[model samples]
Target: MRRNPLGRTGIEVSEFCLGTMTFGSQTPEDEAHAQMDRALEAGINFLDCAEMYPVNPVRAETVGLSEEIVGTWVARAGRRDAWVVATKHSGEGMRHVRGGAPITPDTIPVAVEGSLRRLKIDCIDLYQFHWPNRGSYHFRKNWRYDPSGQDRVETLAHMEDTLGALAREVERGTIRAFGLSNETAWGTAQWLRVAEAAGGPRAASIQNEYSLLARMADTDLAELCVNEDVGFLPFSPLAAGLLTGKYQGGAIPPGSRRSHVENLGGRITPRVFGAVAACHEVAGRFGLDPVQMALAWAARRPFVASAIFGATRLAQLEHALGAAEVVLSDELLAALDEVHRAHPMPY
Candidate 1:
């Protein structure tokens, strides 16, 4: 695994970040620990989690279970320094956490302390807002997304307020860097601008859904990240297994997330299968595993700092790690780009 700089925070992490969303949900603690051990063995020092993780249903009782699981591992292993631990403060719409409250200046301290206690760590390597309180266009909300209702003054005030709070956490030595998720380029710029002006943590990275099927980041978002030195941490780089062809022929594999979830993780696009077929065909022409190719394509993006991948099973995690060494050539990338052009905005 290759180490990449995590924005300008001076933190270097493996390009492959192990996502632990299923740590205490679909996966047992022992299995999750084993996966973490294997990840460390494979040179993956970065791990991504959220306070609202282990997310099959994200119930109130299970809200911090994922962090607790990782905390237990951290305590037992006593190797907290060996990993770049990243976690998030849940934003609006999460009723289980702080009554679905939006991220505000006042919520930062409570949230940070909770995460630190649950993770058994004095400081977090990267702390992120799960989503903006003002709302975001991500997660298939783009079709109905409208910014006309937003109050510019109120939004900028929120940005500055939150930045001040985040900087306080940094000063308190509770967080090393601040990041965003499910944010837009314009929103990102404002955060950067606010930090630059008021003296706070600049947005170090963004965690969003980017994959072969979702190429919204390829244009403006890509440019902003590359120029601003903000890292792109893409989750669901495989299109939630669509690019792997496991959902091909309209067949859901046994024990897959699709078999249980009604909406299959909120990816309900009519052109999805067509897009997957196109990608699989390209991978076949290149004689590459569709899974590895999908991951490698996402990880090799110019603005990507790390690609976050989750798994319910050890075998699945191992398969994803195999992409670490599978480098895509220029021709392969160009062919993939053609595939993207052919089936753009699948979701």
Candidate 2:
């Protein structure tokens, strides 16, 4: 596996990151453990989790189950220093955590402590904010994303507040780096400016929905990452498995995300299937596996530090890991570009 710098944090992580969002739901603990073992054996050192995980069916009962499962593996394996662990702090609208309160200076220490206790680790390599306190355009909310209603003063003040708290955590050795999820270029720029002036920890990375089906990060965010040296952790590189060609012709497989999420987190639409067909056409035309082709394309993006993927079964994980060796050809790249131009935003 190829290693990439995690921004300027002096930490190197593998090109592929294993996502544990379904650790306790679609995947049991034993399966998740096996997935972790297989991923580590494949040289994937980046592991991503969150405070409020097991997201397939987000219930209060299963809020911290994913972290707990990962914690058990960490304790059982006793190889704490073998991988780079990344987790997130829940933000506003998370009803199960802190009474749906937004992330604040006071909540920072509490969230960090809870995550540390759950993951059974002394320190976190990358601590990310799951979403912005103000609001985010991610997860199919871009249609009604209204930034004009935001209060700039309060937003920047909140950024400064959280940055100071994170800086203290860094000084205390509870966390080594800070990052963001579902953040925009302007928001990330504000964070960088505040960190520079407040003497706080720099924003090391940004995790967002980026893949062949989702190309929102190919413009401003991509340029910002390149210029600022921020690691681009593209989450859901498979588009919730839409690009895998498993859900074609309205045939929903049993135990699949579509069976659980109905719309696959709002990814299912009349046009998205057409786009999927076009992508599969290109994949077939090149004699490549759709799964391997999608993963390889995502991992090779210009500003991508690592492409995050989640697997509910051992076979899924192994198949995704095969992309580490799959290389894309120039003609195939051109064909993909043609498909992208035809169906830019299917959803």
Candidate 3:
């Protein structure tokens, strides 16, 4: 439950952030409340949700339900200030959010207003672009990612416009800071460069899939975070439960992410099993729970400010929060580095 600075915003957030994408889909409202209560009791003061969430199978009918659930908790408990609430503006496609249109300057106010109305909150702590309108290589698209045809001038215009709108929100007291998700290193740098040149708020964080199985952030993203003072909010520190070793040996427990996503969003290939086994062995050597070790490993990264983890049940959340105090030793960290060298880029 250590608190870390969120970029240079002067805001401190819990090292572990509670992700609420499951709030209105896989979990009920009462259960979501219980998870939130448990997290706060365990010293997790950061919560992340989105305008389009409950997304195991994101649909139009259930869109925004996650925020509504969080809104209910905020309204009933009157603890909006107790947590650092972060949410996103979905990029495009999916047809359910914003009619499949990309996030634009006009859409910023509209999206923020919807989130405000749904969450019953006046301002957001960290508002992020779910992805770049130009598209991203994240979510297993790296193999086929191609940005050669993208127009840099148009992209810069978009960044300037987006930052202008966000600066307006800052003036209006609707958003405190901005972040990026599923973005490339160059894309993020342009946003930061423009924000600084325009005297607007700099992009404070980048949310991407970073775990034992997916180490794409270790190369360029990590360097950017170190140089820019931008925080890394890893979305799946457990590799969607693969690092927990629960899905080892081709076993899929009922109600697990693997049960629904089968391959854990293209993360379940043959190469991943060895990495999972190695991590499990590492945890056993240290007498630590695999789940806690996985989370703590991600949280203790030099560039990571917070590790975002989701739980469908309260017990699952409790297991994740236990990682808050599980500090890794130099010996264990070296072992992890060796494992990474052996099984880099499983996805």
Candidate 4:
């Protein structure tokens, strides 16, 4: 329930953010609403969603269903202002939206308008680019992630032009802050530079995959966040449910994320289960729920402003909420760090 500053935007958000990517796919509308209600009641005031959500098996037909569900909840409750809503603009490679077009100056207004209309909100508190148009190393693409062919001049020009478009949205009161997702330190710096030069919305946060199983953000990106004042929002703090120990012992429970996406988005690996077991052992030593332990560990990072987590059921959400108060002891943190050192980059 602790609130932290969202970058330098003067906006305070809860340490934990409820992710709604499963709303219309793995979860139905009524259940999604119930989960939201439970999260809010548990002091989670930040909600994160994206235009390309409900994404276990992303399809054109259900592209915007997640946003619509959130909008319906807001309309029915008449409390649009109760939560700090953050959503994304699909960057590139999403065929369902704009025919797989990369985000550009011409597409900003169109995407923003679509999100606003679907969410039934006048303005998005935090508008984020889903990913860099140039591509990123996230989602298990690091093995072949090569930036050698990127054109610097063209990238900078594109950033400046995009910032200009975002500036207009800010002036029109359509967005309060801007952010990046699945981006790198260099990419984030360019966005910040462009925003400063154009007097556009400054980059307020960066959402990236961070978890016990994924530590890519613990290096350069961690330093960038600490120095630049851009809040670090770690998505999948539980490693797409890998760190929760449910997928341990090769048991893929019915209706689990693994059952839907067999590899959990390529997170499944020979070393992953062993790492999960190591984490579970540490939690057992401290008599802690592994789910809460994993979440708390991510939230307790030096540069993290909020840790985004998702749940398909209300019971799972209730378990994750306990992480808000489960402060890990220094000894426990060291143990977790040891495990990370042993199984670094398992996926």
Which has the better TM-score: candidate 1, or candidate 4? 4
Error of 2 at 269 (Å): 0.8
Please give the lDDT score for candidate 4: 0.92
Whole-model lDDT, model 3: 0.91
lDDT digits (tens) for residues 210-324 of candidate 2: 9888999987899999999999999999999999988888878999988888898888889899999999999898888889899889888879899999999999998998899
Off by over 4 Å in 4: none
Q: All candidates' lDDT scores?
A: 0.90, 0.93, 0.91, 0.92
RMSD of each: 1.1, 0.8, 1.0, 0.8
Question: Which 10-residue window in model 4 sums to the lowest lDDT?
Answer: 192-201
Model 2 C-alpha lDDT versus the unseen true structure: 0.93
User: In terms of lDDT, which candidate is stronger, 2 or 4?
Assistant: 2
Candidate 2, which segments miss by more than 4 Å at Cα? none
Backbone collisions counted per model: 0, 0, 0, 0
Model 1: lDDT equals 0.90
lDDT of 4 by residue, 1-347 (tens): 79999999999999999999999999999999999888889889999999988798899999999999999999999889889999999977999999999999899999999888889999999999999999999888899999999999999988988888999999999999999999999999988887787667889999999999898888899999999999999999999899988898788999999998988999889999999999999999999999999998898898999999999988899888899879789999999999999999999
TM values, all candidates: 0.98, 0.99, 0.98, 0.99
Which is the better candidate, 1 or 3, if ranked by lDDT? 3
**Tens-digit per-residue lDDT, 298-322, candidate 1:** 9989999999998889998888888
Indicate the worst ten consecutive residues by lDDT in candidate 2: 243-252
Please report the TM-score between candidate 3 and the true structure: 0.98
The lDDT ranking, best first, is 2, 4, 3, 1
Best by lDDT: 2
Q: Which portions of model 3 show Cα errors greater than 4 Å?
A: none
